[model samples]
Target: MSSPFSNTVYVWQALFLREALDRFFGSRAAWAWLLVEPAMHIGFIGGVWGMMRRNSMGGINIQLWIIVGMLAFFLFRRTAVQTLHALDCNKAFFAFRQVRPFDVALVRASVEAFSMFFISLFILGAAAMMGLDVLPDDSLKVLLALSGLWLFGLGYGLVTSVCMRMVPDSGHIFQILMMPLYLISGTIMPLRYIPLPYRDWLLWNPLAHGLELVRLGFFSNYHTLTVSFSYLYYWALGSIALGLALYRGLETRLVTQ
Candidate 1:
């Protein structure tokens, strides 16, 4: 007999790919929005901020920094937000015998996250061509940062999926949390610039840790970002555990609904 793990892997991969393609083509307009919306938001925000603080926002050029920060941030935020409603949105797919609620959420979140990752790379490449200081100084750390962000999103996505299923009102709770996360995560400004009390406060936000690591990876020339490998590892583990537990408890009920 074939290895059970291999068999399961094949099934999951096939389903994942199929769902991803379906999602991509099902909403071509939305996919286009993903690219254009981020570009416009980054450009508009970066331009506005860069113009006002041309004097003291680090000589590294505000627009490019914002591009890096926003792109990295949008990936996690969008994925987490999407996950909150993934189950409710794909109720039809869950009606099918073969597709589990968890699978629908996982597949959708993965596809969107993966697409944003590639889009981020394309943005970086274009930035490089335009003489933007977007290249990573330590490529390995950059990979680590990306891996951490993806894991954080996946783990959190799973948790959010289950939470929303259990408590329908969680959709609004997620929105409340998401609004403050952008500021705390150091997406618009460097952590070093923050005051001591607030800096310590911000460090507790896992996204901040990930973003700091990414910033250090990219701009090794200036700024200091110290992230503990253990911190990221623990957050990843906790998010996955909580997510799996919640999903297991509510999977059956969610499937029926």
Candidate 2:
């Protein structure tokens, strides 16, 4: 007889493959579109910023800065969005008693992280060919920062997904929040450009801290507001903990609703 642990392993493996296929091959040229969408956004933003004739930021290529920063930010956003919708999309799969809502959430979030890594790599490689420095000065720092951001984003999605599932209309408010978040998180605009006092207030935003840390990791000379992985992780862990509790308490509803 198969043990419970073995059954879970089998379920997770199957879920991963199913999610990965749907993500990369669900649409015609789906994989190509994934690569192209972000590339276009980075290029257009970099070009517009380039017109300002600002070549370097904190001693690194401004375009490269934009590329990496945007990539980091996108990783978080994509993971959250995918995880938020995972339950609804995988409702049919819940017919299998072994499959659970949390299972789908974990699988979908993992797929998004997997996709972002390749997308970032492809875009960065293209930037290198274009002669922008695409190498990180502190690769470990970069990795840690990116990982922290992804974790927090996943946690955010998990918590909000519960909110969304409970009240379908709540998803609209969460969707609206992303726009203001993008503007304030320093993805397209540098935080330093924002005046003092207000900028200090922005630092209270975990995304802002995550973004600044990512930039510091990429450029040795980069300087921004002081950041704390602890601060970011606190939010990450807290949200994930809350989300898991909600899922545990309301698993049947998540699958049914």
Candidate 3:
């Protein structure tokens, strides 16, 4: 059902993905450390939160709440960071005419997406084994919300990648900005915990809505009346369009650099 050109693209994509993974993991021991890091992070956060609040937040299991939020946030952050630096990071591969900067970014995004999928499964499975409720009440909704998060990150990455390519130093500024965005996006705290006027302002962030939708899918009783799927989609689509437009305009400079 696929044309030769599409199949050739697939082959290049796979090769790039493998190269990215190799560069990321570096060794078998690094892979083991990667698995341990998330577990420790989740444990520390969950343990601290569990001590402070004995009951579930909004009737969702505390561990599940943290894990879901963390995974969604992590996926976006990881994908964006990877895509943002894809060009400069893999510039050596550009020696091949088939390996465009866009291809590098695409391969980096694909690698992060695939890595997150497996990492999420491991976290959820580990939580389930620990007797936490790791199952989603609405699987389809969760899938959509998570997919939106990834797509949004991919789009945002495209824009940022172009920006970074144009101005290499901007990458550092973007990394610094991501910290506050991560906290405000409700990675460690639920929106319900925030007081009135502040909650209204945080809701303006599209990622906050995506995180809320993720929670909505995971917990039957959990509900966020403020989340707007349309708003999130608008930003996601807008970013992708703008990024593509910018990339096309600067493709010549990007390829030369």
Query: Cα deviation in Å at residue 158, candidate 1?
Result: 1.7
Tens-digit lDDT track for model 1 on 79-191?
Answer: 77776777787787666666666666676677777888778888778888987767678989878876777677777878877777778888788778877888778887778
* TM-score sort, best first: 2, 3, 1
Name the runs in model 2 displaced over 4 angstroms.
Answer: none
Worst 10 residues of 1 by lDDT: 53-62
**Each candidate: RMSD to true structure?**
2.5, 1.2, 2.2
TM-score of each model, in listed order: 0.87, 0.96, 0.92
Clashing pairs in 1: none
Residue 96 of model 3 has an lDDT of 68
Residue 69 lDDT in candidate 1:
76
lDDT for position 187 in model 1: 83
Stretches of candidate 3 off by over 4 Å are 1-4
Runs of candidate 1 with Cα error greater than 4 angstroms are 1-7, 53-59, 95-98
Displacement of the residue 89 alpha carbon in candidate 1, Å: 2.9
At residue 168, candidate 1 shows an lDDT of 82
In candidate 2, the residue pairs with backbone N, CA or C atoms under 3 Å apart (3 or more residues apart, or in different chains) clash, namely none
- Report the Cα lDDT for residue 86, model 3: 77
Among all candidates shown, the one with the greatest TM-score: 2
